[model samples]
Target: MPTGPALRIDLFLLAGLFPGLTHAAALGAAVDYAVAAERAGFDGVWLAEHHFSAYGTCPSAVVLAGHLLGRTDRLRVGTAAAILPNRHPIALAEETALLDAVSGGRFDLGVARGGPWVDLEVFGTGLDRYGHDGFAAALDLLLAGLSGAGTVAGDRHRFPFREVAMVPVAERGLPVWVAATGSSTVGLAAARGLPLLLGMHDDDAAKAAMLHGYARAGTGTPRAGHASTHLALVADTVEEAEAALRRTMPAWLAAAGGSERIDGSAPPRRDAGAYLEHLLAIHPVGPPARCVRRLAATVSTTGVRRLLLMVEGAGERRRTLANIERLGREVLAPLRRLH
Candidate 1:
C-alpha cells in the first residue's frame, strides 16, 4: 500500500435511491453508515447530491450532513458537491453556516456547477442554459455569503439585497471546497485559493496532471488534503472482487447515465466477467494488497493526503456495512500506521 503523511480517509455514499425506498429509509441508512464509519475510524462521510434520479437519492446533502453530524461525535459530514446553480447562494450559505455551528465546524461545504440535462431540467435550467458565467456568478455569491457578506443587484440567484451577512454566522470560517474536473475549473478553484473536492474516475496520469495543475496554480488541500477514490474489497480472491465489480458497476453507470445496458444478455455491459476484466485493469479493485498499491499510486500522483472512498452499494444494508468493515480492516488499517 502507498505510504506517506497521514491520509484522511473518508467514505462517499453513492447508494441508489431505487424503487420502494422511502426517504426516511434512505436517511436512516445514511445514519447507519456514518455510525459505522466513526466506529471503524474513518475520517468522514461525504454525501452525493442528485436530482430526479435513482443513481443518487440525497436531494439535500447538506440536510443529511447536519443530520449525520448530529448523530456522530467526531465524523465530519460533507457534500460531494452541492449543485450551486440549482440553489440560491444565500440559502446554501445559511444552511452551511448553521450546520457548521451545530457541528462545531465539522461541516465541509462542496459547491459545484450543476450538469446532466435531466438535473438541469429538474431545476428548470437546461444543460445548454447553465454556462460558466452563470456558475461563476452563483459561486461569487456563495463565497461572499460564506464570508458573511451581503449581495447586490448583479447576483443571479437573488438580487438587490442589503449588506446581508450569512445569518447564524459559522462558528468559525468553514472550509469550503469546489469540485474540479477540467483544467479551467481547477484553475478557477486555485485562483481563489480554495481546495478541491475531486472526482474519482480519472486515471493516475490524468489525475497527476490535474494535481500538478493545482500545484502550479497553488497548494490548497481539501480537508487535510485528500482526493476521492472509487473503492471495493476482494479479500477472498481477486476473481470474486472482479465479479462484484462487474455486477455492481454497470447498473450504477447505467443508472447514473454514464454507460448503458443495451441488452441484458449481451457481452461487456451485462457480462460481469467481461466487464470485470476491463474494470480491474483500470480502477482500485483487487485483493487488499493490490488495492493499497493502486490507491497509493493514486495518492502519490495526486499528492493529496485525504481519500474519500466511493464504495459500491447494491442496496443491501448488511452488504454496505460489511464492505465498510472489510475495507477499513483490510485496506485502510494497514495504511493507518503511516499517519
Candidate 2:
C-alpha cells in the first residue's frame, strides 16, 4: 500500500437548476446532497457561487456553507468559491469570521477572481474589477481582515477604510484557498502563502504543471494543503456511467450558457457536447475501481490531499445520493487505505 497523507474526499455542489426542476427544488437538492454526503462518510462539502443564471442558483456560497455547517456536525463545509470580484472583501471576511465562530472552525473560505461577467456590473464592482489588480486589492483586504487585529485599509477600487475594527474575529485565523485556472491567479495565491482550489477541467498533467508553477512563484514552504475538483460518477459499469452522464449533463451545460458580458456583447456559446466529451475523457466518471485509480493518480501527480467530487451531474436527486453513498463505500474507502 502507498503511504502518505490521508485522502480527504469532499462533494462539490454547483446547485445547478436542471431542466424541469424548479429553483426551489434545485436548491433543496443541494441541501439534501450535503446531508447525505455527511452520512456517507465524506469529509466535506464545497458550494459553488453563481448569480443571475440557472447554471448555478446559489448566489451566496457563504450563506449555504453556514446552513450546511449547521446541518452536519463533523462535515466541513466550504465555498468551492465565493466570487470576490462581485463582493466586498470586508463584508465577506465578516461572514467568514461569523461562520467560523458558529461552526467551531469547520468553515473553509475559498475565493476566486471571477470572469468579466455581468455579475460584476450587477454587484457594482464594474468591468474594470475583472482585472488582476482589482482582484489583488480585494484579496489583500480579505486576508488582512481575517489575519490582522481587525484593521484593514485599501484605496483600490474605491474601497478605503482607516483602522476599522472587525468584530467577532476568527481566533483560529482561517486559511483562504484561492481558486486558480491560470498562471496569474496561481502566482497571486502563491505569493501570499495561500493554497489553491484547482478547477476540474484540467487533466492531472496540466494540474501538476500548475502546481509546479505555484512552487516556482512562491517561497519554498507550502502553507496550506491545496484542493482539486473532478467530475465523478459511479455505476456498475463504465458504459452505464457514461450513458447516464450523456443523458443529463449536456442539457445542464447548455443551460449554463456563456458568461454574459457587461458591454452588451454576446460571449461565444460553448459546445456543450464537446465539453462533456472532454470531461468524460479526463475525469473519473466510471466504476468504483476506475474512479479509485483516476483519483489516486490525481493525488500522486498533483500532490493535492483534498479531492472535491462533482457527483451531481446526473441532475437527479436519487441518483446523486446513490452516487455519493457508493463513492464513500467503494471509491473513497479504497483510496483512503492507499494514502
Query: lDDT winner among the candidates?
Result: 2
Scored by lDDT, model 2 comes in at 0.89
Q: List the residue pairs that clash in candidate 1.
A: 225-305, 225-306, 226-306
Residue 121 of model 2, lDDT score: 80
Candidate 1, 175-251: lDDT as tens digits: 67888888877877776777777776567787778878887886554344536556555446777766665666565
- Residue 214 local lDDT, model 2: 94
Off by over 4 Å in 2: none
Counted clashes in each candidate structure: 3, 0
lDDT, candidate 1, residue 318? 69
